[model samples]
Target: MDHIEGEPCQDIEDCRLTDRHVQTLLNREADELARHFTGTFSPETVRDCVEDSYTHLAATARIRTHLPVLAARFARQRLEATAKNQGATMSDEPEVLFVCVHNAGRSQMAAALLDHHAAGRVTVRSAGSAPADTINPAVIEAMNEIGLDLTKEFPKPLTTEAVQAADVVITMGCGDACPIFPGKRYLDWQLDDPAGKDVDQVRPIRDEIDRRVRTLLDELVPSNA
Candidate 1:
C-alpha cells in the first residue's frame, strides 16, 4: 500500500525524497521492517538498513515511483542475510550465493536454476559486483523458455553480509569484488557474460549454468544419499 501519489520523478535528483510526504512513507517502511525483524534486529538497525537500501537503489533507479517498495524489499533481503550471518536465525539447509559483474545475466540464471533444482533443500541468493538498473531482457527470455520466470527479480548489489551468510559462495565473472572470509567455501565459475547477447546466444549459457547448478545441488543435498 506504500505508494507515491504524484507523477513519477524523471530524475533521481529531481525526486524530493526528503519531503514530508516521502518521509512519512519511509517511516512506515521502517516500522514495518522493524516489526518483521523484532527479535533478531533492533528498530534502529532496521531503519538504518531501510535508509541505506533506499539510498543505494535511488542512485541507480531511473524512476522513483516504486522506490519505497523496492527499498523495503532490498532491506528485507539484507536483514535476512544479516540475521543468518549473526546466527540470529538458524537453518539446516545450506545457503548459496551467486556473484557476477551484472546480476542481470549469469548469476541470475545460476541462482534461479539452483533454486529450482534444490527446491526447499537450499537457500539461494544472487548479487552483482556492479548491478545493472534492470535485468537483461534476453536473459529473462532465455529463462522463460524453460518455464523459469525472472520478471519479478531485480539486480541486487553485492553486500558483505550476503557473502557471510552463505555457506558456499560462487563467483562467476566478478573477479575480486566479493570479500574473502574465513570458514566459507568459494568457487569461481568461468562463464561467459550475457550482457549483449540475444535469447539464442543466452540459451547456451543458460543451459551450461543449469548443468552446473544441478551438479552443485547434488553435492549440496545429494539425492542419492
Candidate 2:
C-alpha cells in the first residue's frame, strides 16, 4: 500500500475535509503552486482561473507532486487562449454579432448555429436593430430540427455598446438602422429575411449560414473543427 503523511480526517466521518481546513490548506497549496503557475501568464487574464484550481487541493495535497503536471496543462491552455485573444481588438475569439430588423429569425438562427458548431472556439452574439416581441416561431422550429436549443436566448437591441463589443458585425436587411462606429468591422449578409419565409427557403439560408460559420471557424480558431 502507498504511504503518505500530513493531516488526517476530521469529525466529518467520510472522506470530505472540513470546510475551514480545506480553505486554509487551499491557501497554502496555492502559494506553493504559484512558483510554477506564475510567469508568462497574461496580465489581462483573470486570476480566478488559476487560483480556483487549488480550492479542492487540500484532500490531495499530501502528494502534491501530481499538481505540477495538472498545472502545466492548465497553464498551457490558458496561455494559448490568451495569446490568441491578445491579437484581437475585441473578443479573444472572433466575436460575430448578428443583427437584423427583429432578432427573432435570421440573426438568432445564425448565432445559434455558430455557437453550436464552434463551442468555446468562437464567440457569437445576436441582436436586432429594433428589438422584437419574441423569437420567430418558424425560426425555433427550424433550429429544433437540428437539435439546437435557444431557450435562454432572447431578442436584444442594437446599440453602440453591442456593436463595438464585437469583432465582426453582420447585418441582415436591417437597412441604415444598424449602429455604425468608426473602426468597427461590418458585413451585410443579403440573406432573405427569414421572418415569413417558408420552411424550404429558410432551410437554404440556414445551410448557407452554416457553411460561412464553418469557414469563419477555420480562419479564426486553431482547429478545422
Candidate 3:
C-alpha cells in the first residue's frame, strides 16, 4: 500500500474532510495562485475562490494528495471563464473540450498543451466520464519539464453543458459517453494512456499531445486571426 502524510481525513471511518482543514489546504496554495491571477484577483479573493473550489471538489474526491493543487487550478479556470464571459472575449475564440476516462492523464495533458500553444486564441476545458481522485504524478512531472503546471489541474466530471458549449470535442479514450450535437466537430485521438506510467513513459504522450494540439489550433485559428 502507498503511504500518505497528513492525510486530510478527519474520521477514518467516514473520511469526510472538514471545512477548517480544507481551508488550511486552500491557505497553503493562495499566494502561489495569486501569481497566476495577478490582475484578476487579490490574494484574499484568490483564497476565497480556492476555498470554494476545494469545498466543491472535496465532496467528490477519493484521494487527498492532489486536492489543494487541483482546487487552485479549478478556481483559476472559473475566474478566467467568468472574466471572459463578462468581457465578451469568449466569442473571439473557439472552445474545445477534451474528455477521457479519468480526466487525469491524457485529457489533462492535451488541454494544457492546447491552452499553452493557443495563448488565449482558444478556450480549453477537460473532463472525465469517471473523474479520478487525483491526477497522475508522472503526468505532472512530464509537464513540469516543459514549464507547464498540472499541479492545479483536477479531474472534473463530464457535463452536457461542456459538450454543448464546445466548438470542437476531442476524445482521447472516452467513447460514447461524450455527447454529440449538431454543428460541432468531433475527433477521437487514439493515444497511449498515461495512467500509472513513469515520467519517461509520459514524455512521449506529452509530446504527441503537443503535436496534435498545434495541428488542431492551425485549423481552428488562422495565424491572421
Candidate 4:
C-alpha cells in the first residue's frame, strides 16, 4: 500500500523493547556468523560484528520473531563483503536503495528512517517497481507518530542509475523487479503488505522497519565514525 492511503488507528499500544530479547537475538546471530566465519575470522571479530549488527537492528525493530535470523543473514552478507573489499578505497558515504511494489509505504519508510537515524552518514533512496502517484496516507500518519514527516516524500520509479549507485539494494517483497548488479549487496525483506491495514496495523510494521533501518545504518556508517 502506498503511504497516501489508509485510515489512522487509535488506541495505539506503546511499543517497548527489552534487553533480554535483544541479547537473545544477538546470541543467535553471533552463532550464525560463527558457523560461516569460524576458521576464516577470529571469534572476537565474529562476536563483535554480530553484536554490532544486532545493536543496529534491535534498537528500532518492533517485531522480534524473525529479527535474529534476519540480522544474521544481513550481518553475514556485510561481513563477507567487507572482507572481500579489504584495503579497497571506498566512498565516504554509503548509498542504500529501498524498493517495493509501489515505493509508497515500505521503501519510503525505510529510506526516511535510515536518513533520520543516520543524520547525514548515509545516502538513502526509495523507488517502486511500479511507481505510485503519491505517498500512502496511513504510512504518513505512522511516521508522524514518531515525529517523522513523510508528506514531502513521494513515490519514485526504479531506475538503473539509482540501483547502480546504491552500495546495497533492499527489496521489500518486490520479487525480481530489481536489476542485478555485480559487486552490490542485495536483500529481500519478507514484510507484510500494509495495503488494507489500518494505522494500528501499520504502526508495528513501521516500528519493525525502523529497527532494520537503524541496524543497516550501523553497518553502513559505523559508530566510530
Compose the digit string of candidate 1's lDDT tens values, residues 1-225: 233434433454544356676567877999998998998898999988887787677666656667777888989999999888777898999999999997999999999999988878999999999887789999999999999999888888899999999999999989899999999999999988888889999999999999999989989999975
Instruction: Give the per-residue lDDT of model 3 (tens digit) for 14-129.
Output: 33335467567778788888887787677888788787766556655767667788777777776665555456234767999999998999999999999999999888999999
Candidates arranged by TM-score, highest first: 1, 3, 4, 2
Clashes of 4: 12
Point to the candidate with the largest TM-score: 1
Q: What TM-score would each prediction reach against the true structure?
A: 0.90, 0.57, 0.69, 0.60
**Model 3 weakest lDDT span, ten residues long:** 1-10
Specify the highest-lDDT model's number.
1
Candidate 2 local lDDT, 59-130, one digit each (tens): 323334343334333333344335434543334466778889878888998899888888877777777776
Of models 1 and 2, which has the larger TM-score?
Answer: 1
Clashes of each: 0, 0, 0, 12
Error of 2 at 166 (Å): 0.8
Clashing residue pairs in candidate 2 are none
Native-to-model Cα distance after best TM-score fit, residue 224 in candidate 1, in Å:
3.7
Question: Which residues of candidate 1, in runs, are more than 4 Å off?
Answer: 1-19
TM-score of 1: 0.90
